[model samples]
Target: MDSISIDEILGITRGELLQGERDLKIKNVKIDSRKIQNGDLYIPIIGEKNNGHEYIEQAFLNGGSVSLTQEKDRPFPEKMTVILVESTLEAMKALASFNRHRYQLPVIAITGSSGKTTTKDLVASVLAQKYTTLKTEGNFNNEYGIPQTLFNLGPEHEMAVIEMGMDHLGDISKSIRSVDPDIGVITNIGLCHIERLKTQENIFLAKKEILQTLKNDGMALVNGDDGFLKKLKEEKNSYQVQTFGINDQQSIKALEYVSNSSGLQMLVEWEGKKENYSFGFPGVHNVYNCLVAIWLGHFYKMTQPEIQKGLDAFVPSGNRMNIFSIGKIKVINDAYNANPDAMKASLDVLETVGADYGRRIAVLGDMLEMGDFGPAAHYEIGEYARKKADVLIGVGDLGKEICRGYGQNRNDVYHVANADAAGACLRKIIASEDIVLIKASRGMGLEKVLDYIEGGNK
Candidate 1:
């Protein structure tokens, strides 16, 4: 595949290109100086621990033609190019903005306090049925990750699905402007980043920034069931808004939903047409994700059969609600990440599935970044887990609060320090016909429990 020429890249003006061979052209962009190639342009981003500006010489030795820097020091040979900028990170955003316009692809931007990753994955999978699609990789939805994802797009791609995440104000604005999207999707705003944002209303404002930089013809796909998002009405200049929901009336709705041991089945109502769809992913909440994907599938003109096939074939990556049978044990590995809403959802699912099984266990960890509400929120979670879960295994300080809430309700409840302890305990306590649900924040790394239970394989 052909590469983006250095000339076409943003923030590469004559003054910025200080002391480089005029004939030099970069084949690709590299933020890490260590991975700089012969014709690569290096951007030195100032991060928390180390500064990329410190490695200009190493980048030169690795064969980079240009290095972007805010540092005043002239580290390289006089002949080599140093792209000077007031802020290398801001310049990176500018570069990403230029690339977004250059490609002019139909972009779908997804943001929310919850379910952004799952919804993005579902939309990308359905879009792939009819379009050459590019999607966000992992949780790379921040300032640096947005630029990198945009630059990774090649000529072969027709649609881009970018997931935007934020912990504070203005993060989404930077992310949205970087990839001026034609379709904006807000999965649902919840209490995920309450530590930084302070209130759900503030979180809604942050996520709505995706619409601020939207292309003229862009459409906003919103969750009609969410009270905060539902309050946002259409203005004259407002992009055409579409809504999706399970019970609440919406543009696209899941009229009736059903789930069993195998998977989920739902009837989606769109434009007065009701279609029954079944997905491999199990959950009532996943039905909403399925609706969004189906809407996007319709937008891309995918046939009903292709959309159905795609939704049915969809499976979550990493640890989002993955079910495994270890010997005689049924383990629900939903350890990708967790919040109050998701934890409750998983507990409900466990309650439903565990009713038929012998025993139910909830192995949970701290839901971080909850600010002052952390302990109380965890306690509420513990109280609910006590009622729904037969055994509760807690990890970290926040989890200790959850265990405390369970109080003298004494069933099988234990608070451990880390995932290693949780994993070790699982090996001993977990047995035949037991159903276990493992969940925690991304930092908790509770997937280790899955590894331990699956014999380090699943």
Candidate 2:
């Protein structure tokens, strides 16, 4: 963060100075006092468990130059910059909004039920060819995280490809009101967050909030192939909507796509021109991600080679379809997060990629947040697992339903209680010429199975 005058912060956050020099320079902004550097601006947050106002003293003691406090009359040490605000969270947002206004560049905000991170990465990768891009890292797509991501924006950045994630209504709106994106991309609406959202319709409406936040002249590239999103023209009457898909009437379309164990090839048609690109990543969902990336790349006027290079360079983050070798065995560690769509896609990749190795082992787990649809979702993935995995080991209570769904593999399919059990099962089932896939929801900690297998603990 660039140095902002204490007076400037007071002006932006509508905060009044309680003590200390108004001319003091704040070179960094941090929430945690332990992470605070000398002259850093500490913004205290009021979270569910503990209030941050109590930590203000500790922050200043540990080299904080400035602090925002919701407590009107907290005892403070003299000579430190202290600012009083209605709410520290709101103050943080206000400060972030002010910081974002400093940049007059393309801010592409991406939101979806899934694939937002991958979409953001691919978009940034493509945009890097023509622009110095700033992107959202990891779970930094929320109100608190997006602002921190934006705070890194300086004079050098030409474009900001932001990922705005939401599990509820108005989450995207809050981020959009902060960053105000130039372009918005909606990957798809699905059952990922349906537990909180109640229905797919609600999830669609929640995801659609990104479009509502778009500028009047801004472009929104939606998945026309998505059954829910394809109806956006009728559901919302706002801006001129652009569509992209594999099999539909749209501005950008994938003319042809093919995938093997190695990678993927696609013929994309957009703006009356056809182009061919090869992707190092596999899975049909990534083809959609590529289409979105290509659209964003083309919109920014990047050459076909640049866009292709970016796509080729795009690697899956988190534990999503990450294919690598584990000694003599090949492994796909997709143990990050899972809904039905992501789980099925990973299973398909497991089936395809392990073909050369001959043996396929899938250590599956529960797909949480399905609500009343949990059983059916697990069943759907389980039924698919029967065809995909030569050996299927299901974990968790929901895994029982998955094992039940894959009835054909009664002998091969075994249900375990947790990652340790799954790892033990995998140790016995996996061999030198085998390909193994480990996948589950974020809560399940399925990566521990991979750790166990890789660590030679089993």
Candidate 3:
């Protein structure tokens, strides 16, 4: 991998070395001033809440050796290293591209509406079995995050799994321009971010933008089961592509699957061989995530045992599909974020795991960004919840629609205003050994309900 001096960064960013050492070798790169360390290059960002430039002194206080700033007229400590740029974010993009191209490793670009993060985790887990892999974590799939992820790469990494996410057009385009992915995977196209893009077709078109940056003759894989994503099927489309799904006949598939709160067991066929495997978590939705991992394993020529070990040892990140025993109560905490498709899948898992006790409880919150689709989407999930769970609790304004749908089937529907009130209402009605599912959009912060009920993570 190529190492950069202050000279190279200035050249790439078109920045002027306003003050400080020309020979300074950047040992690390950080965007947050509070995390900047001695010998680290700090890029202060202009965010919605605070200007990073205002924290230049703080960065210096935290031992930041070099800094990138756009403020030209500001006074600074004597002889300190400062690179002046037109835009800190644009400069970060330029520097990231420079840093990325220096390493000749293959970059797998993973993108889709809902399960991108989980898919990224599975891909990393499998690939790391055979290679020193670097992957994106947390919210590190965006513009600033991608650049920071790139900067974290060192000479030890043998491969890169870069996750790209977008809300509008050109978001993934910009990230891919820097990543130059050798392989591309689209998990599935769904109704997420539709309010901004308006329609599913528009979302499909926006997702296609990831294809523009594919390496020459690069492999593209998508969910063959999705009505929208199945459009990527080659005879039916343009790019040469493979498919992965449970039901798609011409794709890699999982047959005869069984899942519970503890884990999932499935018979998956790949490359003319069939094997049964078990993973640490339960969700039919995760079968899709594993399908992507299986094909990626084949692409890298990993042994079946290697792939199975990787899948078997993997645990989901954060709150997505995480089931825990809190005292005498069971809590399914899928509260990281929510959309209609994700909500429905989580419900399916809840129904499966909670079937024994049969006291299945669902505490649902509003699915945001639906625009005009809000009412109808909520109604669809609400109607399904009525049939699936024994008792239903609805939170958020749109949740009233869920209550209405539940009221159609049963009388035990309770509607609450927000997470706090929902937490209070749930404590009053929740019983021992009753399986509880708590999920909502990030804005609802429904995880707090677990704190109210079981005091969380017992």
Candidate 4:
């Protein structure tokens, strides 16, 4: 990041100079003290378990030039610069907003219940064909992550793809106001974060917050297949609205598509022109993701060939549909996170991959933070998996609901208490050449089963 003077920081954050020189500039900003480098600005965050105010000394020892703190009376090392703020997080957000506006590049903010990361990666990959694009790394789509992403922007970056995630009504508004994106993309509105938002309608309202701070002439792209987003297309709006999906009514539609173990092939119809495209991932949901990237590419005046090359060059981020083999068995590690929609999509991939390789085995764990909807969601996934998977191994408490939905009469359906039990059960029942799909929410730790299988187990 470009260096910013302590004076500029104080003005942007409305913070007070607590100690040391005001003329010093910060070349980098860090929240974690352990990651502090020479000439970096350290901002202490107050989390539930641990307070970052305690790490200031360590940050200085690690070569931090400056620090921001909420503690007004705290002692500091001699010759250290400290800025005092009411809230370090709010100060950081202000600093990030300031940094974002300093660059004149077009920022594309993406938000939705699912596929946000994948869509971000795809959009960045396509834009990288002609521009030095910077995207949100991994699942850094929350409040802290969004600001950290913005702080990484430099003069070399020509475009930015920021992924915003929300669990409440105003989460997107907070991030999007800082971003002020030129284009806003919503992948789909689903039951993700239903525990906090309560209903799909509430979730849609939360997701639509991406447009709250959007530029007046900005473009809004949405999934037409989603009922909520489709309704959005009919609403009166200040900005331009366009839809992309496989359905015929979308502004940019995928007329035909085929999914297989190798990848997906699609014949898209855009602007009365028909063209074929391919991606190196196997999922129908990914087709929807590709359409967004295609629209962005065309918006920036990229040719069809360039757009296709960008799509072809795309790669899935870690733990999201990451495919690999263990001896004769194939594993699809979608263990990063799962909801009903994502689980169903992965099961569909398992069906397609297993069709060409071997038996479809689904090792699914509990989807956490589902509140009262947890049982029915898990059970519904199980019922869906019954048709897609040849053998179903359900892990965790809610996983039993999946087994129940798949039917207890079936000998192939098994319910284990956790990932450990699922690992042991898989060791006993898994056959050679079988394709396994491991999926669960972030809290489920289902990656342990993949670890167990990869740790010298056939």
Candidate with more favorable, higher TM-score: 1 or 4: 4
TM-score of each: 0.93, 0.97, 0.95, 0.98
Local distance difference test scores for all models: 0.82, 0.85, 0.84, 0.90
The superposed Cα distance between candidate 4 and the true structure at residue 303, in angstroms, equals 1.6
TM-score of 3: 0.95
- lDDT by residue (277-379, candidate 1, tens digit) is 8887566778878889998888778877899877866667789888778888998889988899899888888887786688898999999999998999999
Best by lDDT: 4
Task: Kindly give the stretch of ten consecutive residues in candidate 2 with the minimal lDDT sum.
Answer: 232-241
In candidate 2, position 46 carries an lDDT of: 79
Q: lDDT of model 2 at residue 29?
A: 79
Q: On TM-score, who's better, 2 or 3?
A: 2
Q: What order do candidates take by lDDT, descending?
A: 4, 2, 3, 1
The candidate that achieves the highest TM-score relative to the unseen native structure:
4
Per-residue lDDT of 203 in model 1: 88
**What ordering of candidates by TM-score runs from best to worst?**
4, 2, 3, 1
lDDT of 4 by residue, 316-403 (tens): 8888888889999999999988888899999999998888777888999998878889999988998999899999999999999999
Off by over 4 Å in 3: 1-3, 235-239, 455-458
Which of 1 and 3 is the better model by TM-score?
A: 3
Candidate 4, which segments miss by more than 4 Å at Cα? Answer: none
Tens-place lDDT per residue, model 2, 1-458, is 56789888988888988888887888867887788889889988878887888888889889997899989888877867899988888888888878888878888889887788888899899888888989988888888888888777877899998898887887877777888877778999889988888999999888888877566688778999999888876655556677888886887898898888877899999999999998887789888888998988888888999999898778777787788987888989998889898888888888878778968988899998899999999988888998888888899999998898888447888889998989888887777878899999989999888866686674
- RMSD, every candidate, angstroms: 2.4, 1.5, 2.1, 1.3
